[model samples]
Target: MKKANLTKIILSISACVLIGFLSSFATRSSVDTWFLTLKKPFFNPPSWLFAPIWTILYILMGYSFSIIWNNKGQSRKSKEIIKNAMMLFGIQLALNAIWSILFFGLCNPFLALIEILLLWLMIFETIKAFKKVDVYASKLLIPYLVWVSFATILNGSIWFLNS
Candidate 1:
């Protein structure tokens, strides 16, 4: 791929992630207020940890997309496959952002738990689809999946304890 095109891919990937993150900015300041009000599980990690974990996971996801896009095996068939996989990836990403909106933006931990459940399932399917196209793509999603699984459990615990 041309340098410019590569830059576009990187930038595009960055934009998508940033938008997802930025969408929650309005709620971030209120996060503590809402979170502190809730009854949390004893195992909940410090809030400081999530950003780093998500940053690494997002970078991995970007690299995974780059690998698929740059693959020589990407013919019409592969193109369709990659595109579909990327779409699913995008959907799960958007679903992730929705959890932030529901949890922090709307301050609804109960609804957020349900949203994270769907996001977790979608991420699982995304990993499977990604595996079919590129093993690296699937591998790249491991941390994302792991972190989300943790979050899902945390979300449930928070909701249950607080309610």
Candidate 2:
């Protein structure tokens, strides 16, 4: 790979990881304190699972986004599509972080559930936009979409049970 592409990949991954790091500030304190007191569903995964899973997901998301970002468009229309896709990517990423803040920082499962629904929608739209730019880039987001789908269910369950 060219140096430029490698740099992009690293930067992309770093940015994603940085978001995770920042979001963890909200999560770390609550996980042992507030979150532990919540009424989680029976199927809820173990606490230790979250960090590794989120780390992997963030890496994948960054790599997927890098693929879209590095693509040089062949025409005006193509460039516009790529630009739109990137914008969607940014939106979804911001939503991802916001969900963490709402749930963990504010200790509001109900609000988190609502925000996560929007996050899921944005992720779906981002996947569609990414497909227009690069099929592989879109494919890379499938795991994220699936994970967030499961998370949506989990979040709803938590809120329902606790409310």
Candidate 2 per-residue C-alpha lDDT over 1-163 given as tens digits, one digit per residue, 9 for 90 to 100: 2122888889998999999899889887698899989999998999888889889998988888898889888999999998999999999999999998999999999999999999999999999998887788788899999999999999999999999
TM-score of each: 0.87, 0.96
Q: Any runs in candidate 2 off by more than 4 Å, and if so which?
A: 1-4
Per-residue lDDT of candidate 1, residues 58-114 (tens digit) = 777776766656554548987788788878888988887788888888888889888
- Compared with the true structure, the alpha-carbon lDDT of candidate 1 equals 0.78
Clashing pairs in 1: none
State which candidate has the highest TM-score. 2
Clash number by candidate, in order: 0, 0
Model 1 segments more than 4 A misplaced: 1-5, 72-75
Q: In model 2, which residue pairs have backbone atoms overlapping below 3 Å?
A: none
Highest lDDT against the true fold, candidate = 2
Q: Which 10-residue window of candidate 1 scores lowest in summed lDDT?
A: 1-10
